[model samples]
Target: MKTQNFKTITLLLVVFLTSTSMNLMAQDEQERPRRQGPDAKALADKRLKIPDLTDAQSEQIKKIRVKAQQQTLPIKNTMREKRARLTTLSTTEKANMNEINKVVEEIGDLQTQLMKHRETSRQEIRALLNDEQRVFFDSHMQRRHRGKHQKHRRG
Candidate 1:
C-alpha cells in the first residue's frame, strides 16, 4: 500500500511539472518579438477606417504598393551589396578610403533614386484620393512618422 501511494504521488508530480514547463514555454514564445512581411492589402484595409476608401481606391493602392515593391527591389539589393562591400573594405588590414568613399557615394545615389521613386508613387496614390481622403491620409502618415520616431527613441 505504501509503495502504491508513493508511485501515484510521483506520477501526479511528473504530470504537474510537465504541464508547468509547457505553459512557461508558451508564455515565452508569446513574449518574443516576431518579424512580419509587408502585407499591402492589410495595410490598405487599415487605412479604410480613416478615409473610408472605396473598393476601386483600395485596389489601386494595392497595385501601387506592388509596383513600388517590384521597382525598388533591385535598387535595394544593389545598395545592400555596396554596404557589405564597404564593411569588408573597412575591416581589411589595408583599408582603401578612396574605394570606400566611392561605394558610399553610390549607395547615396541609389538611396536618392529610391526616395524619388517612393515620392512619385505617393503622388500617384494621392491623385486617386478625394479631398477628404487626402486630409485623413496626410494625418495618418504624420501619425505613423511620429510613432516610428517614438519607437526609435525608446529603443
Candidate 2:
C-alpha cells in the first residue's frame, strides 16, 4: 500500500510540473510575438546591409519611415474605404460604372500620392547613406519593391 501511494504521488507531481512548464511557455509566446531582444536592433541593421550604421543615421531612417507611414496611413485608409465602396457600387442590381469609375480614380490618385511620399522617403535615406551602403540599400529596395508590386501580377 505504501509503494502504491508513493507511485501515485510521484505521477501527480510530474504532471503538475509539466502542466506548469507548458503554461509558462505559452505565456512567453503570447507576450513576445516579435524580436525584442537586446540584439534586435543590431540584427535589423545587419539585415539592411548597414552593419556599420551610426546611431544618428538609424534615428534619421527611423524618423523617415515613421513620417512616411503617418502621412500615408490616411491615404491607405481612404483607399480601403473606397475599395469597399467600389465593390458595393459594382454589386448592385444595376451596377453604376460611373460611381465605380470615380472611386477607382480616387484610389489611383491616392496611390500616386503614396508612391511619391515613399520615393521622397527613400531619397532621404539614400542621401544619408555612404556610396557602398547606398548601392546595397538601393538594390535591396529595388528587390523589395518588385516583390511587393509583382505579388499580384505574373512575371
Candidate 3:
C-alpha cells in the first residue's frame, strides 16, 4: 500500500512536469489566439489587451500560463487531501502533533516548489521573447504593477 501511494504521487509529479514542458515547447513566435477552453480563452483575451501580440507571442504567453497552472497541480492536490483529512480526524487523531507536523512540512515543501516552478517558468518565457517584444512586455508589466499599487494605495 505504501509503495502504491508513492508510485501514484510520483506519477502525478511526472505528469505535471511533462505537461508543462510540452506546453512551453509548443509556443512559437508567430501564432494567434483562438478560443480553446473558456479559461484558456479568457487568459488569452486578457493578455491581448496588454500589447498587440503576434500569433507567436500570444502562444508563448499561453504556454507560460499553462505551465504556471501545471506547477500548482501537486500543491492543489495536496491541499485538498490535507483539508479532507483535517475535517475527518477524530478528536484523538487531531491530538497527534507529530502527524500534524508531517502534514505541515509537506505543505511547506509544496509551497516552495510552487514558487520555484513559477520563477523558472517566468525565466523560460523571457528566453522565448526577442528584444523588441521583451521591452514591450516588460513596460506593460510595469504599468500593471503600478496600477495595482495605485489601487492598493487608494484603498
Candidate 4:
C-alpha cells in the first residue's frame, strides 16, 4: 500500500510539473514583444556603412525628429480622419478623383513643411558634427528622403 501510494503521488507530481511548464512556455511566447520601427533604427545604425554621430549630433537629430512629428501632428490627424471617411465611402464617392487629389495636395504640402523642418534640424545638427559625421549624415538624409518620396509617389 505504501509503495502504491508513493507511485501515485510521484505520477501526479510529474503530470502537474509537465502541465505547469507547458502553460508557462505558452505564456512566455505570447508575452514576447513584437519587433517594429525602432528595431529598424538599431539595425540601420549597425549595418549602414555610415559613420556614427557624436553624442550632440545624435541628440539633435532626436530633437529634430520629435519637433517635426509635433509640427505635423495636426496634418497627420486630419489625414487619418480623411482616410477613415474614405474607407466608409462607396466606390462612386471614392471615384471622385478631384477630392482625392485635394487631400493628396494637403498631405504633400504638409510633407514639404516636414522636409523643410527636417532640413533645418539637420543643419542645426550638422553644426555639431565633424566632417566625417557630416558626410555620413548627408548620405543618411538623402537615403531617407528618397525613400519617403518613393513611398509617397506609390501612395
Candidate 5:
C-alpha cells in the first residue's frame, strides 16, 4: 500500500511539473510581441531609398497596404483565436483530438490565405514601381524574406 501511494504521488508530481512548465512557457509566448509583418509606416514610407519614388506611387502604395491590412486583419484575429483554442485543447486532461485536429486544419488554411494575400499585396506594390525601383523593391523584399528564415535556420 505504501509503494502504491508513492507511485501515485510521483505520477502526480510529474504531471504537476509538466503542466507548470507548460503554463510558464505559454505566458512567455504571450508576453512576446509577434511580428506579423511590416507595419503601416514601413508600407507607406516615402524615404525608403527606392530609387526616387514619386508622390503618386507613394500614395498608391499606402492605399494598397491599408486595403490589404483591412482584408487580413479579421483572418489574423481568427487564426489567433484558433491558436488559443488549440493551446487550451492540447493542455486539457482529456484532449479531444478531433477538435484539436479541426482547429489545426483551420489555422493552416488561414495561414495559406494570409500568405497568398501578402504576395498579392507585394505584387500590387511592385506594379507601381519603375524598373529601377522594382529592382530595388525585389531585392529588399528578398532580403526581408530571407531574414525571417535565416533566424529560424540559426536557431
Candidate 6:
C-alpha cells in the first residue's frame, strides 16, 4: 500500500511538472516578436492583389526584392546586435545615458536607411504596375498601414 501511494504521487508530480513547462514555453513564444524577412513579397502579393502581372514584371519585382533583402541583411543584423546591447545596458544598475543615447541614434540611422531602401523598392515595383494597379497598390498600402497602427493601439 505504501509503494502504491508513492507511485501515484510521483506520477501526479511528473504530470504537473510537464504541464507547467508546456505553459511556460507557450507564454515565451507569445512574448517573442514575429521575425519578418526583408523580402516579404508574398505579403505584398497577398495584400495588393495586382491583376494581370506579367511574368517579366513579376521577375523584375522579385529581383528587386531579393537585392534589397541581400543589401539590408547585414545592416539589420548589426542593428539587432546593437539593440541587444542597449537592452543589457538599460537593465544594469549603473546605466550610462550617453552610451544608450549613442546606441539609440545608431538605431535611428539604421532605421532611416532601411526605410529608404524600402521606398526605393516600392518605386521599382510601382514602375512595373499599370495605372489601375498602382491605384490598387496605394490603397492596399494605406489599409495595411492603418491596420498596423490599429493593432498597436489595441494591443
**Among all candidates shown, the one with the greatest TM-score:** 2
- Assess candidate 5 and give its TM-score to the true structure: 0.68
TM-score of each candidate structure, all chains considered together: 0.70, 0.71, 0.50, 0.50, 0.68, 0.69
lDDT of 2 by residue, 1-155 (tens): 99999999999999999999999999998976456778887666666776467889999998898999999999899989999998899989998888888989998999999899989999999999999889888888889889988886865
In terms of lDDT, the best-performing candidate is 5
TM-score (C-alpha) between model 3 and the true structure: 0.50
Candidate 5 C-alpha lDDT tens digits along 16-101? 99999999999999986554576645544633668788888888887998899999999999999999999999999999999999
Task: Give the 10-residue window scoring lowest on summed lDDT in candidate 4.
Answer: 85-94
User: What is the C-alpha lDDT profile of model 3 across 3-79, one tens digit per residue?
Assistant: 99999999999999999988876774236556566687676567646455567766777788887898789778887
Name the TM-score of candidate 2. 0.71
Q: Tell me how many residue pairs clash in candidate 4.
A: 0
Per-residue C-alpha lDDT of model 1 across residues 1-155, encoded as one tens digit per residue: 99999999999999999999999999999986444557655654854555578888888988998999999999999999999999999999999999999999999999999999998888888899999989987787778889999999997
Point out where model 1 deviates above 4 Å.
1-44, 47-49
The whole-model C-alpha lDDT of candidate 1 against the native structure comes to 0.87
Candidate 6 backbone collisions, by pair: none
Give me the runs in candidate 3 sitting further than 4 Å from their true place: 1-43, 87-94, 130-155
Q: On lDDT, who's better, 5 or 6?
A: 5
In model 4, what lDDT does residue 73 have? 82
lDDT of all predictions: 0.87, 0.88, 0.74, 0.72, 0.90, 0.88
RMSD in Å for all candidates: 8.1, 9.3, 17.5, 11.2, 9.7, 6.7
Model 6 per-residue lDDT tens digits across residues 34-107? 55786475666554477887778778888998999998998899899989989998999999999999999999
Q: Give the clashing pairs for model 3.
A: 29-56, 30-56, 31-55, 31-56, 32-55
For model 6, the local distance difference test gives: 0.88
Give the Å error, residue 76, model 2. Answer: 0.6
